[model samples]
Target: MTGRVGIIGIGQSNFQPRRNDASYPDLVREAVVIAMRDAGLDFDDIQAVVYSLSPDAMVGIGNAERLGVDAVGGRNKRFLRINTGGATGISSVITAWTHVASGACDVVLTAGADKVGECGDSQTVLNKIWDPIYERSLPLGTINMLAMSAVRYAHKYGMTQEDMARVVAKNRRHASKNPHAHLRKETTIEEVMASRMVSWPVKLFDCCPQSSGGCAMVLASERYIKQRGLEAVWITGLAHSSETYYLGDRMGRGFTADHADAHALGASFRKSFRMSGIKDARKEVHVAELYAPFSNTEFHSIEAAGLADIGTSPAMLREGAFALGTNAGAVVNPSGGVLCTNAIAVTAMVRIAEAALQVWGRAGERQVKGARVGIASGNGGDHQFFGTMVVEA
Candidate 1:
């Protein structure tokens, strides 16, 4: 059970507003085929299956993983479904990693597809997650939840709406170079500022698009990797943490994690970084794939990952740090992040996948030069659930 595991293959389908041509199951198959081919393994080689699907309401189908059971070769193998709101993807990947690391399975398959574009009222469906007994009274959906966080972050720090605009412009520029990204068109700071205000400082351009796509990953034990002589990227460190369910509690202090700063989220990454043998993340980490679906959230998410000091990310970002061609030590979200493409169940999984791709040196034009260490984060449900992972080449 002490076996080491690594990500041997990764695949993602083209993300778009909708995949009208393909059913959700087809999307799963598309990604699975690509991942299997990338790993040079047959479906028979997979000993376990971890299906990553979050919020069946988004897809309007209950237990949707059932539809893709056959596609993932889970008919007779061990199978489990995972959902932790937005963190479902990485959670599922971690589950697969455990299967191999535990010596129960030499190779495990993790696959998921999301069709949030098909949901009639995505926000309403997502809002049901709030506690009707306490928090539901505020009608806090995804945007306004982070919008309030933005207000607090701005108040605590000197971040202006212009800072948020720059974040949008920078991510859009990154997305433009990534074909798998949903919002690929580059935008300017002026353009982002001019966009419609969705939730105060969180402009329409600052938000992630409702995307539909699929992603799959192949993981194997180190023994299996060596036996097969396969190329792989090691999952060096990983962990997940959570905040209190109530948004009000995260307001001031003394709660799970402060809204003004991602201390709890930082705790999660620090645990992973240490486990991965990273003593100083700011200098050791060269690339990061963060799950900041909104522009303003990226600042704290970066700080939480130890990529920058808390409350200093906005200024560092303003100076063109974290951009692709910058001299900064680390580049965050080279795949344009979830702000460019957010397929709910697969979003966090895609973060790790993008990070693995960067470490694998297969990130195409969006690749960070000489990227050796990559970290990814997944945030779910009112910022309650946070997960972090570290990968090394």
Candidate 2:
């Protein structure tokens, strides 16, 4: 890195199943305006833009980012459009960080809007991500594909459905503390168990809602921050990884990574910790905003982040190890996580944004106390693509 990169501002609109009052670009502009205002900067100061948009079909608009260019005032500036499925958000932030870190720009804006709930053929669109001949015939999409992983994780680790239900109950209780969360109603473990099952172990409550919203972040070099005397959170480290397209290739005895444990994700965390000059993430990371869209996935994600070990995560979780206001472990998913509010294209960005907020002491009701170092992650494309980020106060 040529220069230190810091997050100058972050903004997220109220997420819901449908944002009917705002048009797609309207949502984009709303977030940009909030972020810019928070940064005390104008569009003219943004030297580059990274648009975080996923599948255009999700918005029923081809090349949808063309409309976003105007919304974010990319008229004559350098622009990049990123689409890494659910990873698009943080991927855009990381790309924008490069522009500033590489000395190509003093300031950059990463922004996007999503209307996932309004996509009528959502399953068809998701189903296309799989290989047409092999996986598509199984008619697999996001839910069952991840449900399969949940099953493997449960079987390998002896995690009961009630154990997973506790994950849902904890996040929903945390969601009640966040105003922008889509599902804020606190729930009990018994209630989660009663929620209709979608897949065998993945209940309706175990899954995340398809939300619609927008989010934006402003990044600047240390030089720019010093020049402006802006309060900011520094991005200490960032990394990305990709898994094999065939989920089967990632599973079983001979594979490099087991589908049950997701060892590759652990490796990604190690790479990020190396970049951050951290030797022990379990001690150094004070907060974590993991992208676990399903309840069972949260356990493995915590392990992958080094917050807990594989078989020990369920036990640690039951001991109130990863809950809000707990001193035991990095307060996991203090923003209710994707389980409570998932706006596909911007969900991962929200993860980093919330992490930054915690580090900045700006995460109001859902803030983790004394979070000096925080980590965020993004998952995309059948658990094949991953991104990890480390942010600091």
Candidate 3:
């Protein structure tokens, strides 16, 4: 997709452990109304809609998008649903972008919601993502899979317990400023380290809380934005990649064993940068909203996003390099990020929304001053699905 594809509106529902007051469709409506209001348009103006979410098992409903079609005003429009696990949100946005960029539609709405907490035994449900014969018998799910990466990261980079703790503490503090974040209280490194361990090196505090939430965005072509006199953030470049199906494929002998380095992520970032002509990511990128559900994962995510070197994130992190409101470097995860909120389906889309808000100067409390270039990414499957995008003010 080429040309100027602009995000003219963004909205999100309040993130929490549960939203008993509203049904799935209701949540979708809430976000769609807010996004439509922001864009100063109605359903009549939308030419198409892209609804996204994870698998049916996660929400315990087959064809979940059907429930939200009317909510997004997709009754008679060209409506479609997207699924790529955690990457669904961002992937949906990119799909909408292509609608206008390809001259298929002048305006499109992309929205979705997830009630991960409402689902029965979310952990048990996620285990289905693995291959039935090769990987299902191990009793593994999302947390321990990433924990393996954390252990490998620690072994490769010599990252300490305190280093991982710092990542959690920083995001917790940042979440305090984000009104829509699921977890907003400030936390200390001691608090994080003292929390019950879910897996070795991945503590309770390190994990993202399962929340019920919805997010929506309105996208338009350059002519549409100019004609409407609306403020917009441009999608300069976007790319996504998938690793091999089985996690074992990502591991081999030597330093590359365990695939802790996130080589796929690095490849995704490099492809996006090359497409966007981003030669110096460290200097040119001003803010990043990376989808790291765990503390230690942030190190690899940060490095893979092209914000730092493979082994240098921990040291840079200790120096306040990725902290919000930093004077000398990019402010990472100003919206507290996935570490503070995880609504599986909408998680990755929230990253794109937060990045766009920073670029649009609309990220009120958590805005990074003079943010020009922002980046966002999503991780899904066994780190199999990856999405990356660069947004410019």
Candidate 4:
């Protein structure tokens, strides 16, 4: 990892509950074509390929990358698959960055897609992420885990259910500006609160949809960027961290509080900030795309990313601070975020791509004004894996 690496191209398909018009590989190609076109490169230009997804069963295919390699022009080139649960997309981009930064290739493509809706019983598939011997008997899923976190947060900070509804309302309004978002309707706090409660404080509108989509990005070295006269955004710093494997290890044994402090996510952001010379996220980082699948998770992620104090995001939301075009505070999740569209394999990568778009001045409608530096993060494996990146124009 000696040379500078940057993103030269980005592409993503319209996220939806199910893509009946396209097969899995066809869905992958939809993004690949757009990415290649954006970079002004074809399959022949991609020296290496990094593919990612959640699990083989999520898409009902074994070695799923093999089915889409030819579509991405990786059939005769170096190709590899990387998965770390929901963090697979950003991890795949990290793999591509390493390939180009290490001089293994000049141009690398990282692409992945998933149809979580097509998979039967996604919750059952997600339950397998927990340890069978210790944690599997509690009927725990991602929603249940976040529900506990939400309850603890309210107890600790006196955050009301209305506060969580405000978060959803803001994001849904933001999603209305994003054509690629899966859920793009303007919502009110009443709408959010009225939505059926899926898990106590966690209501239906508070959760992200099961989206079927694909996302891909092209990473290139400085030499390639200069050679092609390409407009790119530099990945100034990238870091990832993992918490203890078992939830019991993170929280003391027999602890009923499933609430997460997101300590690992905070640590990952601090490392990325230190590496990129970012002293203050609220000042230096103009925009952020945090991986929060549920509305309540946004508070944890916002604090972990250093965008707000541990218990202050709710107040900030009420004051119009994190709003998309506001000059009041750091704009967050302008792409509507995972709260509006969760493609699992492509969710986190879409965060990175959207940040890059902001830096490159290409994020059209959802773009934040005067956003020179942007940050993105991804969480995976029951919040065990966390990745953060700082990108600049």
Question: What lDDT would each prediction earn against the true structure?
Answer: 0.91, 0.90, 0.89, 0.87
Model 1 clashes, total count: 0
Q: Which RMSD values do the candidates have, in order?
A: 1.0, 1.0, 1.4, 1.8
lDDT of 2 by residue, 1-393 (tens): 566899998989989999889999999998999999999998899999999998898988998999999999999999999998988898999999999988989999999999998898887999989888888887788888888888888778899999999999999988898888999999999999999999888999999999999999999999999989999999999998878788888776688777776666777788989999988888899999999999998999999998887778999988998899788869999999999999899999999999999999998999898899999999888887788999999
lDDT of 3 by residue, 237-289 (tens): 88988787766766675433246877777788889899889998999999999
Query: Per-residue CA lDDT of candidate 1, range 1-393, in tens?
Result: 665788998989989999999998998998999999999998889999999999899999999988989878888899999998998999999999989988899999999999999998999987888888877777779999899899989998989988998888888888898989999999988998899999988999989999999999999999999999999999999999888777778765556567767766898999999899999998899999999999999999999998888899999988989999989779988899999999999999999999999998999999999999999999887788888999999
TM-scores, in order shown? Answer: 0.98, 0.98, 0.97, 0.96
Return whichever of 2 and 3 wins on lDDT.
2
Q: What is the lDDT of residue 326 in candidate 4?
A: 82
> Model 2 TM-score?
0.98
Instruction: State residue 228's C-alpha deviation in candidate 2, in Å.
Output: 1.0
Error of 4 at 202 (Å): 0.4
Model 4 per-residue lDDT tens digits across residues 1-393: 666898988999989999999999999989988998998887888899999777777898987888888777876799999898888888899889989989989999999899999998888888877888889888988998778878878887778889988888888888888888999999999999899989998999999999999999999998989988998889998898987776655455664323456888899999999989999888888899999998988988899899999988888888888888688767889988999999998899999999899888888889898788999999998888888999999
Write down the worst ten-residue block by lDDT for model 3: 250-259
Give me the runs in candidate 1 sitting further than 4 Å from their true place: none
Residue 13 in candidate 4 has what lDDT?
Answer: 90
Better of 2 and 4 by lDDT: 2
